[model samples]
Target: MNVLCSESMKIEEEVSDDSGTAAVHSLPTELLVLIFSWLSVEDLALNVSKVCQRWKDSLYFRTLWCDKELIYENSREDLFIFVLSVAPALKQLSLNPLFCGDPAAIVNAICKGPKDIRKVHYNLSLFPAAVASRILGHYKKYVCELHLEGYANKHSSIYRNLDAELGQMSQLRSLKLSGYFDTKWDKKVLERGCLNLHHLDVSLIQDESDSYKPFLDNVKSHLKTLKLPQFKSNVGVLELVSSCTELKEITLCLDDLRCISTLQSLESLHIRWSDGVLKSKMNRFVRDCPVFGNLKELTLFYIPGLLATAIAKQCNKLETLNLHGITSCANIIKSVPSLQKLCIVDRLSLRMRHIQKLPRYIPNLRHLNVLGSFLNKGIPPKIISQLKQELPELVISSEPFVRYTKRGNKGYFTKCTDSSTDCSSDEA
Candidate 1:
């Protein structure tokens, strides 16, 4: 604590030199802009912008704001308008529902501004659907990513307007819809909208109808990644998936694997928590497809020991594996001979024997990440020392919870003790 205070004092002294001859002030504008980019948007608005005329002017550097994500949350409406006018290169915008003022006004402001935005995240419940539709139409030529959160009932007019406008977004590449949407009423519109999408996430929708078939069929030839709501015995959906020859990654319940086994291009697969499929199905899939030779990444929430061993036997070239609720690691280690990274989460039964045997089982492993409730103890320092000695090239990290934050112009992880705070998985 004292060290941190001393460092802060030094930074304050360097920043507020009375003679105005601080070395930092002499840095080039490009270097100064790079330094300010390390700070958060709030810090830029409330702290650095008030520093001096030169620093204030540096904020206008186009590269500084191009990739910055502007999210409207508790900040003033006029401030958003100011940012929208100045940060013309901003590529992503997220309008939060908690904003005190009207969200439509901000959307209106964006429509009149530059069309450089490529991604938008909006909530239908926060504003009128007509306004949302108009904004979509205005930016259809440039916007490539759209994430819409819906709370409308089956009969709401919001779906009708959104569906009609979505069809015109020719540049759309990614679409994610959550909550309730009128899938049946928007079937034709979705087919047109989804024809060019490479990534689709509908895992949070509450519909169980075949409306997904049209969306899937339109993009079957080029879809690369898909996140489905749940794995069901819908033969129509399965048949469509079987024809998605270009699919490279998917997240769904591993209930039936026959359809996906034919995806020779599949590089990654994630089995959701709800997958309670029988082991017989898994064995048959592994036996038939020989463990998807092209598969490089696998995420398993839980699987029987026999099934895990059988799957491992065929995963000789798997590069990354995420295991949750796994009690034993022997069966998993044997198959991934080419594994480079492993993440084990929420398992308490990880023993020292398993840790010591990792190098022998997976000789090419380069990184090991262990996350669980006993994070405070981490891998006992003694075991870590021994493992380091055995595998000097390997990198290891332990954490109780995964969260990211920026500190002193650099990224680092911090433990989360409070439940109210949100933990960002992405790096700051």
Candidate 2:
């Protein structure tokens, strides 16, 4: 009681010299704190905190600083440290590699931060061994997701302690390691520590070798998603993939469709930078397996045209489809009638006439993102504007090619995709 009284007295003394009180002072402290909670760190420091002693003291309120996520980027070390000191209830923290401050200070600040932080994304290899150990030790129990970047090798023993530290994180569910990691990673440690780990992303690692087999073997039954490098056919990888009964989402090259066919529980598939597969094989694979029947999302990047069309026909429940660097998408789009979101990127030679047929192909599409060099190929902005006018209810974003005007209050009309005719006038 004395502490509360003394604190209130200090605030009163600080404001006693001021003659006139602002109308904002009429609001209760709780209400003021609630209002201030909506403000950013910079706003609080440079604007509201300078308003008065009363407002400044309100900044110290525990409830006011309980932000769920914090991303440190281009902020001063002192200010960043100040924010970290007050923000004890942070659930996630992302330290950008481009952070313009003393790395040691920020790292130390994180060491002293809230122990219950669930997600941490930072490069632990930048710090000394002791500092890194302190951070790993502090967040072992609380962190469920980690995006760590560091140096490790399969042949030599560099950052081997990192493997040991990773083993201590028993609650880890998702891990994305981007560095020079190799097969020397202690699979037994991960298998023992991260039993619930369902998502693993090693796609960004410099070492393109199939070092993911160890991780796959460890958490195959629990894994729900795997983002790996290019597809490499091997007996061990094939066997490990087949055993992943709970796997749902996988991002890899479509070089080996046979390995993917075995994943009956797969819900999402991303084929990145792959070609040279026969159309007959893709058609037969889709015909033989239930891969597309259960899929919700599909991303085709530099893959065969028939593979996309074949899969699209079976994806009755697909919600999202991303076609990147693929020109022949008319058949693929028409096949997925249930698609809600469609993203097309880098269609260099895509004609404006083909784009006008979006509504005719996918009537159910709620969101459409058409971005790439296609807009630069002598295409006018009026075509997209006409699309907006035709389907006022449908959301469209065409960036880097044509800028969309901010939507205004307009009467909703029946979408052309809902019409019986093909709508191939091209009057716009």
Predictions: Cα RMSD each: 9.3, 8.6
Give the per-residue lDDT of model 1 (tens digit) for 248-274.
998877674667867888899887545
For model 1, the superposed segments whose C-alpha errors exceed 4 Å read 1-20, 23-28, 48-55, 98-100, 152-155, 185-195, 231-233, 373-376, 400-428
Check candidate 1 and list the clashing pairs. Answer: none
What C-alpha lDDT values do all the predictions have? 0.71, 0.71
Stretches of candidate 2 above 4 Å error? 1-27, 34-38, 42-53, 61-75, 96-108, 152-158, 230-235, 275-284, 376-393, 399-428
Q: Residues 86-153, candidate 2, lDDT per residue (tens digit)?
A: 66666777764532458777777877877888898876545565666777778889889999875552
Model 1 TM-score, all chains together: 0.81
